[model samples]
Target: MKKLFLGFCLLVGIATKAQTVADQPFLQDSADKFSLKEGEGNVNLLQVGSDRNKAIKVLSSQGLMLLYEKNLRQDVQYRPLLDMNIVALTEYQGQFVYLTEKAVLSNAWAGKLYINHGIEAPKAMGMGPDFLTLVAGEGNFAIFKNNQEVWRSSIESLNPISVQYDPNSGQFLLLTAEGLYQVDSVLKTAKKVFDGSDLTAFSLFEDTIVLGTTNGIQLLDRKTFTLNKLDQKLPWTEITSVNNIRGNLWFGSTKGAFKLREDGKYDYYASKRWLVDDHVADIAEGPDGSVLVLTQKGMSKIDFEPMTLAQKAEYFQEIQRLRHIRYGFTSDLAMRTPGDLSTGYFHDTDNDGLWTSMYLAGELFRYAVTKSEDAKQNAYEAFEAMERLTALPDLKGFPARSFERDGYEVGLHANGFSEEWRQQWEKENGRIWQLSDDELWRWKSTTSSDESCGHFFVYALFAELAPDKEWRDRAIHQIKIEMDHIMDNDWYLMDWNGKPTAWGKWNPEYVNSFPINVGDRRLNSTLILSFLQTAYHFTKDKKYKKGAEKLIKKYGYDENANRPATVIGFVEGEDLSNKWNHSDDEMYFLTIPGFVNYSFTEEQKAAHFNAAKSHWEVERSEKNPLWNYLFALSGGENIDSEESAWWLREFPMDLIDWKIDNDHRKDLTKIAPNFRSQTYTEVLPGDERTLHLHNGAYRNNGGSDGKREYAPYIYLLPYWAGRYVEAISAPQAE
Candidate 1:
């Protein structure tokens, strides 16, 4: 992946005509990883009882613990019963009650401690209306009322797993693996109501008794005791816990937690994107319309907030301005420890120019549509970053990939090239690091097509969309100089050694040499043509126009550029040709707007538009906002804004590169690996998968240890692009 960074790392419905209404609020999911602060919450919130309350009581390895919302979703605080070894906990009459091996206590009454009626080592407990029940084993049970022992039972046939109290029925039900049993108030005797096995969880859904078995769900009429079984249609079959919060059915399984929607669909929350671990221990309702799920590792709160796309843009804009920008460039935050922001330090990448340009493009688009001063200032600052890149290397027209202060030159980061061979390769590729003339900085050499593509793309955006005339002039000038350098050098980016960098070649010699199945032929032809066309559009220079037309008419680059990406297949002997080059996709989409918008004639626009349409047809399945919006701007219709909105709303607020694995999911329909490496029948939603940027939405699984936090450009670029094209509207006021 080279500049694409192959760091051993790495989907929703469509909207066909939903963007017509401007400033409308759309649903967005905000994930609360329930990030643990030291000494604040329990290591594991293993809820053991059947108490269905917003205040969850549990038995942690640290002893007894009570989970509470402390600082919203950022910090879920837990109070542990450190001094006492408590076994079970429950809620009775709106107060927390607890049981130890020896006795029972209530946080509501400090001076009152009741004996457990010889139900030692209690593991399960429940309370309802005026009754408290504790179970130690299959046959041992103790019932208490108002701090007094009421009933004790020894029934050998009962193997109690959970205890639930139905408020409507005024009855306490004890659930065992064998069946459901009802306990009467008078005898405190247990009678079998339903005959079933492998039951794991129980909850009362209004007047109905909800039973969770290993395979499916069973609902019983609280008064009639009649049963209704539900089909095993769930994200995961093995149900570990079930709870009804405000009439909504929520279930926790071994894989993830899901909410049963009214339409029989489930809103699944899994992976590090939603929870700390997929193994959900328990789930409960939390403060502010949030759903709290306790996992094998820790807790997570899925917060549902109503906001417009504009509000979301502001949120991400603030995040980028706060933590990601470095020297006006969108930079990745490197973390010394996994998932720790305190250890994060902003760092540069080889494609800093490319990424900054994308961020800059989004800002310019934002300024054009919203006229926000902050957006304008953002564009100006990013434009300055692009300017600094051109000047840093001290090369007249060739920009450095990135630069660092003196003595910060690490070994070469060339993907296929080796460190041991750095010296031998330098002779051919030129010095990978060159000392700045001032002796205070070092610039990375071998500037790539990624940087080139990014420079031109943003330069065109700033020239066309930036509100300020002075800024537009500066961008237009840079566009001319950069294109002049590339064209004058025979369509190759020359390093200090006067040789083309390995990947900076866009000449017909290099491009046309590739076979028809190879992507570089089409991509390279499109790029150089776009560069020349954009240069001519602003500069109106005959050389730029002649250069673009020469490529199209003389070398037949028009044909090369119009082929669909589906034509790209495995070219057995070549390295890059062995797989689809995703970086090339970014290069093409970013360059196409410039190419199509600046066409020399109407016929040319029609032809270039054909090229864009072909690529979009291939990419349509991904439902990428940036790509789709770019297509809409290219005069295509029926581009789904719903898919665009779904992508935007489902994107997680968390940007940390946490390790994720979806390969083990049983709910997915697995497919044999294809050219794109697609593994699932359908792509999962944005919130459920890893933060893959443009490279993914196709890959099913990837792992990272919070070593790097991604820049929000991935979200911002598409959002503003969608906005500029009117594919997405401004946020509506509340």
Candidate 2:
């Protein structure tokens, strides 16, 4: 008995650890944390001390200067050393050696400049602690020792491009058109370590020597000197410069600069993130491990710091709070124009309730996982806003797109429109109504089928999870009214004009008319099933279940639900169904968890689960976190958990819709655009594509002029759902 009890305890311990792992945070937000100290002109050279407190020295067109921070502040302080056109600054044999366009000066920082005129200003130079090597013209080379010439030689066959001193071997490695050559101070002999042509630059490391060649970066073994090409994996082939700082390899190319992490993956920084220009001229390291990138335009310092998962969650939460206060309540705007979050000038999309419903679902999951009062309150507020949308219109359960004050203009269009323009817009936007005989209120009409999906989705969630009995009853009441209106109108959402809205028709006549392979047929059939199931789950009404069964038996709706997965790929001649509708994808996936969770029978659950799995298989290449989270919730696959985490991490923290232009980027791997999907091998989703509702993220072009700030719910839904399903672990406490 004691042994059995011990075994049970062991199992309990293992289960607890597993749950903790899932609860631990999986992503964090990271930005360039280093502040750049701009220079007057192009930076020629950068040097720093080994100590953390030491200041950095920079040589530029403005002259030599000391860059340091007085205290922990955002700005940097500079101290001038000499206001001269200095090209290079280096420490040689315990003295500061300064190179100019005309002459070489020593001890310039000590107010006593000793000039060396034996060798004219060389095109390329290399400095060691005790010796200096200069390359003049193409291959004419000379060595200097303490302001005196030691040796001079010329290898006219090899065109010398750059020079570097190896501290480990105490010798100069010269990069020439032939290969890398090691030369001694006497210049009597030169030994070729590697046979390589077109070497632009080179850096020596403990185990390998990295060469910047025309093809790409080449890694050569220190002893054997064999070449290993990295061009296939690199974003660009033309390697211009290379630097090794504390094991992190920084490569500069004609396209952009990238740092190779210890894990062997490359982190690319371009497009105004860490560079002022794509052409990287040189790279240096500061005392505190910051990277100094010198481009053709100027210099930029980037502090590469890894963010923790807890920080990411916190950032999203804060953004969610701000967006909710600004735009999530009342009539939720579909999208905000770039940099206009405060004034609420946004696009009043047709699916306001649908967007808010997804956000409400996220809050519901948050409440379920954390039991935080704030989560419950937020869910209640969004529910109230959605509930009011149904009450604004008099057509029984017909919910409006959104609502506004009676005096407010129909669309509330942007400024600078003429009075004549408002008259024509009134027909489209002006649908005012009075709910009561005495009171006046207006709401936008012409509701669609997608709105019904969102309505049922949130109503089902509220019915199942609302902490208050009154709120649960309200949810059920709302569901009954909406379902009754749809059924009584012959499975169509009739608008205020007594005509079915543009997309609200789901009757057999309309649904069955589409070809068997069409998306509308599958989508309408699947939406009706989810709607009926949700109504039955909340009301326990036999009529709702009977309605669903009739569709499956009569119109082959069950077969139609299975057909959506096959049509996920592009089909020739069927442009409407072939072009992936991301909005419909959003509506489809959001309905799955509720439909499956509240399913009435084992058979029903099986059908819904299989349909969801099939769709997920098609969407796996897109790597959408929300879809992956929903699939995992339905017990499809958890392998996407890590991928879901990656999506959340890749989401930009800057929610503004800034114009992103990738056309000029040479590092991007462009593929042929197709109807199936657009993809790039080099750029991530946020960088290459616009923010959209569906898997359109893989469609790589768009965001040229501006981007729209998506509602925070878009991110919150997947995050909280991942946590609720144990696909993402809670972050460990800091």
Candidate 3:
């Protein structure tokens, strides 16, 4: 008996919180708004002026340093006082004042350092207009004017965390772990305004006080003295310091830094993109709206604004140029890198035809949207590459995995080979083909159903959209030959050995053998219907329609098409549906356009749409940009325009398959391991997950190709398609 799996209940426990306008104020946009500078060691404090024209000071392990904010340069231009054991630095009444344990530096204006005598050693200090309040051990507090003691007082709290003076309130605020207090300048009374334990940091706004505690941020209403908690959770709970910079709240925490926008949403910066270390010591707003982040490793300046769509389009175009010149072709065995294109090393890929077809489709959409000759030329070149795959194989209409030069056979290994397979290649002269006059070109055999789906999908698009008559005629011819071969071979893709390819079975005997709930049964049924409908529409063949109707009526392929994908954890046993195959999801969604566009009747199209909708609903949790774009193009419900834009922006500038490990991050919220879902509360999968895993199994898999880099097509396809479908608006000039 097959193990039973629970379905929708699993999702109910893990569904993401509803996104409200108040909660998600910022639409996640991508742009170059941040830059980093590595200091000698950890930076402990940063101070900048409210005016955008002032110089910023940084205190690190190296010593006191200065950085100019004129052009956002990262160079450390001045070290006024180096190798000094400085306790605190502050600006009081337009004058720079800093202190050490044994000495006091007073009014060190205009690059000159001066010492002031007659002031006792103070543990902490707060600056006010023309005066400074010093706090020493044992609750000793004193007010000094021009280095002379004017008044003195005593308080009960021995451990004071920080001291700040609010000009509007005309009082000094002292923060302690026990509570917050307001002290007047007369050397006497202290008023306890709010009582809170475990207080780490506090920042005073005009009428409110923001406190950072072990829980999260707490807002104190000074007039009412009532405390209200912020519902927005930080990436980590241990909030270290809070700074109110021009109305924006910057929360520095143990894990990273978060900036809460005025509109109530937040932006996070951490882990190499904006921070050299995760531990944020302090945060200060720079002169030109940039933020200076002091971390354990160094300081990073992040401009918190998002990028415009025009900039994103330009970025995508540049990536395309780099990829086409460096990593465009492939040879044999789906080796991840496919050889470096820049240095003249080329290899074959098992699905070069399939992958290239998707890229070609993207270019077709780009051409349609922009009317750029460059896009048309790119589509034409990719079409030529795919067409070569079908011609290089020995079987009349079978497509080869890939083709390459004859001399490069160093690491070629076929998937499931027996002695007969080796004999066919070495003795009987089978499986390999020489296409060039000098016999320099060779092609690998054994094409699967994935290649077939890609071929038909692209061919249908070419037939409908290609501007040149020659291209349209070639597409139709390819479609007719491939469909005829499959039908003639009893609905299976026959390999060069006269045997059906392992994944090329779509016949009734194969598809119907699986149970109704199996993923393969549903996936194969949807694909075959799409293939038949496409062939009939392009070739105007009645036999193709007849085969489709036979499958729908006799074999319940239509019912299979409408069956919803199982919610993985709900099912038990080793069922194929128990795990998610993102590859199958890609094939399933890619086939929908052809299936709906070429259906024989409105009823048939409606059924395909319903199936597409059901599949997309299950897939929405993945937040895949490509899947969302395709679903929107197919007229699915609740098209996520904001999310699609986010995916394009969040896609890393580097397409190289770098090893990313997020399992060790402490800030992440671990959910029950579900093999079908990639959703996590800490970060989006697109931000940290591997590109290959987007189409592979989600569990027990060491995600990503460690040796190779991905091409730009992964981003270009969805971006162009979204542009063509008008799901994404054209970016305006800034």
Candidate 4:
């Protein structure tokens, strides 16, 4: 199945609600205005709204706080003129009730009420004491005594849909989707405020009213009708909801939600993926500065500071373990080809018996610089083996993929196609042929799919090895060609091969190759890191310097685009989509630290730091432990902070964390198993899965010489980042 239909449906269900607008609203009259403020935490949350002559104040759950005019005497007989009942009460969303016979409030107010009510739908208001005024969603504002309406009215056209009493301005406000207006409840007359504007989402803070338009957020001064453009950063299609948490004015929009600066400026903070979707379904502050995000998929909570620290410790440890594992495991295998007298340490243990361990060897050499011994011997050996393999002619183009005794004779042909371009030319020029005696021989073959990473390793290995002037020159040429073809202006790499096919056709590429791969921009960061590492290692070259600079400017950071410092790629499920059902709106801020101190300018570093704070403040989700640790490493906070302590406790499962403690951290036997699994649906017949599995097994053993896994490259990360490298290079005896 294409999965597109299911994906679309899931996207709609979770993403549609993200387009609702909710911002601060204002209570104002012809000459006066006041703001609405909500309190925080364990303290009673105060709700205040005002019109021209009267003020309304409620302590929320604690009942009415105060209801005095701007200039009213404190000793005056105090009483609530209206006896409306609260229809709903929640931490963020609130509602009130009144009778239907009462005059309707403004449609603007009505729209606000409906949106705040969420999916519960409106409850019917009953007829009671004569209705004085009516407020729809913020709860009932008018009083109804007995069965008749409260206040006497002569204006025959007064049929408002929503009404609210402001305590600061001492006036009555009416709202309708069509326009916003004011009413004199005592005089029984109405006057227009703003007309012809679609005020779908609104928030009131003091005398200022925030309106969400189809394009962006608009701020209006209630007393003067002065309009101020609030959001000019990017396209803001919908304001799903707005609320004040702690001191931050949080905005939930169609394109994810953001936290605004408390100082009234437009500085924003949020998860990298907040803008990936068009609408933000829900937002709430979690314990210890964590953020709760409810999108279409489900609810996810993240604690950034703590999570980042934990993951960093974990990731660093994993790098160490993978390094040592590679080093120890490579001593166990024997090579099957005629060239190498040396034997590899790994052997097939889980699948059909066959030895194909060179891939792991190649990957290790690519990332050997991190481990000292790897840099000393393992890396050189792996390169030596690859060179020998490349030099040997493919006497049998198609060898039998089987490992059985009979299978050994199944292939008998020469396929000159090699891992390098030389073999490619030989295959294309018809110099390669298959013999009848060959077992794995096929008349035609396609360059291996999913081998782009291999090519990356090869280039990385070449650059790192730099055996001589000739080798270095060849490496430089190859690196440039690969970079020119695979990287776009956006700094995103094409996951597919760039080489022309038999038909001389190039594969189409996407701006981001995340989803099609493992949903991680590790490759992007890898390219960036590799370029920077190459530049740092080979300081004589200016091209590497330019490459590093280009990457920073192209795919670095953007508030409007909602890009965060660390990116964990995008997930492809229903609970993840935004209101627009567009994948472009989603991102996870991981991989930030991997590039945090590498190849970035001061401005870039500052931006990345800000993003790290935001990720910790709002984006770290419970579903992604890896994101938290990465954040912690880049946070630059105290190593023993509460967040750091939390990370220290979760050091076992995380490979990075485990390595930090020298692999002394123990895994829970009953909780998480140590075994790993991967499906090979596209496996070729007779291909040895056991050797592939073995090649990957040694990564966690503190040896950096595995052939299949990229443990060596990972093992080298700490060295480049100024961390421990010996963890990846320790000998097996030690």
Best by TM-score: 1
The residue-by-residue lDDT of candidate 2 on 1-734, one tens digit each, is 11111122233221111112233433332233222345433334333212243445555445554544421121123223344445565544434556665556654356444445344445556777644545433546777666577777776565666678877667788887679888887546677788877778778766888888777778887666787655546656677778787777878877777777566656665544445566776676654456766666555666544554446656666766665442345233334342445654443445668877877888887777789898898888888878877786778898887665556424543222466754554576553233432346566666777788888877877776678899989988999999889999999998777778768888989988777766777778888888887788768899999998898898888778766476655546765566666667777776776555555676877787787777778677677878886665555555466666767776766554444445544446767766545556533645334555543556443443233455667677877777766667766543
lDDT of each: 0.74, 0.64, 0.64, 0.33
Candidate 4, residue 499: CA error in Å?
A: 16
Candidate 1 on 1-734: residue-level lDDT in tens? Answer: 00000110111111223254365675576676654456745565666332434554455666654445543122124243466666666556556666666667765556364655577446677776644554445477877777688878776756677787776767778888888888876666778898887899888877788888888778888888788666576678788889887688999988888887776667778777677778777777665677778777667777788878778878888889988998888888888988777888865566778889999988887777779898898889988988877787766788888777878655366534666677778766666878888888888777889888999988877876777789889988998878877887899998877888888998888989898888888888888888998788778889998888788888988788877666778887867687666677788888887777667777877888787888878777777888887676655567777777777776778888877666665556788867776667776777667778675557556858768788888899888877776777666676
Question: How many backbone clashes does every candidate have?
Answer: 5, 9, 12, 145
- The 10-residue segment with the lowest total lDDT in model 3: 1-10
RMSD, every candidate, angstroms: 6.4, 6.8, 8.7, 23.5
Q: Give lDDT tens digits, candidate 4, residues 1-734.
A: 11111222233221111111111111110111111222322323222222222223332333433333432112122233233223322221222321222232222234332222121222222221232333333323333333234443222233334345554554566554556665555565556677635555455555676665555567778676567655544324465555555555566655555555344433222222122122355454544454544433223333344223213424443453443332122222233431122432232111110111223323333233234443434444443433322122232111112121222322222222234654555555542222223444222222221222233334443553444556545544544544443333233232112223231111223223334222233233433444443334333456555665554456431321124423432346623221111111111222233234332355655654564555445322221222333343344332223322222232221111111011211110122331121122121111111111212321222322222222222222222221211111211221
Encode model 3's per-residue lDDT on 530-568: one tens digit a residue: 898878876778999999999999999988887766522
Q: What are the TM-scores, per candidate, against the unseen true structure?
A: 0.87, 0.78, 0.76, 0.33
Largest lDDT belongs to which candidate? 1
Rank the candidate models, highest TM-score first: 1, 2, 3, 4
Please report how far candidate 4 places residue 132 from its true position, in Å.
15
Candidate 4, backbone clash total: 145
